[model samples]
Target: MPRRVLPLTDVQIRNAKPREKTYSLTDGHGLYIEIMPSGSKLWRMKFPQRGRGDNRLSFGAYPVVTLQEAREKRLATQRLLLQGIDPGRYRDDKKRLAAEKGSNTFEKVAREWHGNKVPTWSERTATNTLRRLELDIFPEIGRLPIHEVRHRDLIDALRKIESRGAHEVAHRIMAVCKQIFSYGIQIGLLERNIAADMKDVLKTVRPSHFAAIDTDELPDFLAALRRNESRMLKPTLICLRLMMLIFVRTSELIETPWSEIDLEKGEWVIPWQRMKRGKLTVNPDTTNHHVCLSRQALALLRELHAITGGGTYLFPNQRDHKKPLSNNAILKSLERMGYKGKMTGHGFRALAMTTIKERLGYRHEVIDRQLAHAPPDKLSSAYDRAQYLAERKVMMQAWADYLDSL
Candidate 1:
């Protein structure tokens, strides 16, 4: 039979330890302290492992853990055991579950999304998108399960941005939510996207009218750009002029690599991935299709290359050599040039479209193809792969000549 009240004084334990080597001192309760070889003591509780003979649970080291504290820990475990729970297994299971849940958190998923999507986006696009997520989405629902995010919850979260009178930000948040939820769906974390059905709830505004500077204003704008003092401003202004002359998206402009530009051939070949329609739909034959450069565009590129050709990007950010300039850099330059309300980066597209269609009388098909607009017929899209190289070359040269004339 076990000793019911096996209390022994500290001196008694110290004296008897050399002979027995180990001894237990029990309070009247279930708590007991074991004295060991190195004069170290530990608290332990004796209990039966159901259907097994006997088991012991070590509460903690003694001295650091007083007798009272050991008794409390033992009583808590005993209470759990009495309630038909195995304290050891219960604690282990809780820890395992907590770890699993942590792995599946929104922050973890956002990180995964970043890893998968960053490579596909331009450096600026990836950085700005991540900044938005960190500032807006992560702070609110970043720890919550992606599947558990409801439509109302997402709408309410974006509503906070709406409350700040940022309708554009609200739209951006919705787009990001859609992308994240779609990613979650693809990975099987969610059955259906809650963000998919939220489109109708968010009202769409009519496209705002922006005034594109005409040919008459081009000379003054170019003069302003040339006269700008900032080291970072000139390349961006040249890029803006190139964008107007060539009429490609700012992303396409900023992400242009030197390897893709054939200075001798007078061409710029944007890859299928960087193309506006993405690679899948663009015909394989036209994969390496080239953009014909004007004399002015070529001269600008030559000068720009002399400065930045050492870098991978044609227009690397001033602050970070590894990164391209921000998409807004050109627009911001225009803003500083007192053209904020009158023109924008996108206004270049409108100016080109209007000039090509209304002023120059270029065929709609030619203009559309140059602008990388989608074709109507899938078969023609696959087969009729024309880069409008000859016509675009002439148009670009004439457009540059017009700017020079201005």
Candidate 2:
């Protein structure tokens, strides 16, 4: 038969005095009060492990945890023992879980997610992503645990960003937050993304179109571009003209490196690292993007090459020769040319896309492919990049001729 032990009373515990050394007074059933030499009282419980013998667990200090509470905790520990669980090990697990939760703040998780993601992106993309978090999200609710992020919390953060007139940044930040929360869910750090429900909650902003000139404005635009009295530098004028002849985006144009262009082969390869790929794609992020160089485009490159050919970049920043030209270089140049709200550097691509489709009668598929638009799937994008290289060369020459004629 098991021996029965009596419970302790508060009066008895409070009346207990400290001795020269620590001494324990049993309340029975694994509960006891230890009176220390310093007159402090501590509540402790000696519980049994399945095969690991006895271990001590703390209920807290005396008076703060009354005898009744200590008894209740002792009973709970007994129940755990009866269920074949070790109270000490269980407590250790709880402590570990708490530590993990403490470290799993929204900012920490988002940065971790960002770190894993930026390897597949361009330097500009990686920099912009981190800048968004630092400027927008981190100051608001970054320190909170991932699960503690409410929809209103994210909405409030993004709305603050939107109020500052950074609408596109707000949009991109929300998309990134959704991805981070989804990542937390995938990695077992969160239950459900409260931020997920906010997918459609952001204010629908009308797409901001860049200032692009019409097709008919091109003849005057070209004539103004080539005028001897033009304020632009010789290298910049050639760059502005080449910007129209190629299907490349203005950003890619500004950062064109000498290594990526092969004049001998009449090809310019925009590495996948520079392509506009979102984080969700399963496609190989490093796919080679080919740009068919037209004869006019080649001639312009050759001419510009004589000037900047010795440098690493085709269009080098005059102030910082080692770096690509500032993204605003061409845009500002156009602004000075009385086309501030009329024509943009990127307007050239739209001009080509519109003209090639409407006037030249090229297929949309061919135009989009030449523009390096990622197809819907990995297989299709792969096939598209390599397909119609020959056809693209012919189309590119005709397109260049059309621009020169204007």
Best by TM-score: 2
Q: Model 2 RMSD to the real structure?
A: 4.2
Off by over 4 Å in 1: 1-130, 145-153, 175-204, 207-211, 214-234, 279-286, 377-387
lDDT of 2: 0.83
Model 2 pairs in collision: none
The list of candidate 2 runs beyond 4 A from truth reads 1-6, 10-26, 35-39, 49-53, 145-153, 208-210, 223-229, 259-281, 284-296, 360-366, 374-406
TM-score of each: 0.62, 0.79
lDDT of 1 by residue, 25-113 (tens): 77655577777766788778777668776777777786688766877887888898889987767778877866665567666777798
lDDT of 1: 0.75
Residue range 294-314, candidate 2, lDDT tens digits: 888899899998999999988
Clashes of each: 0, 0
C-alpha RMSD of each candidate structure in angstroms: 9.2, 4.2
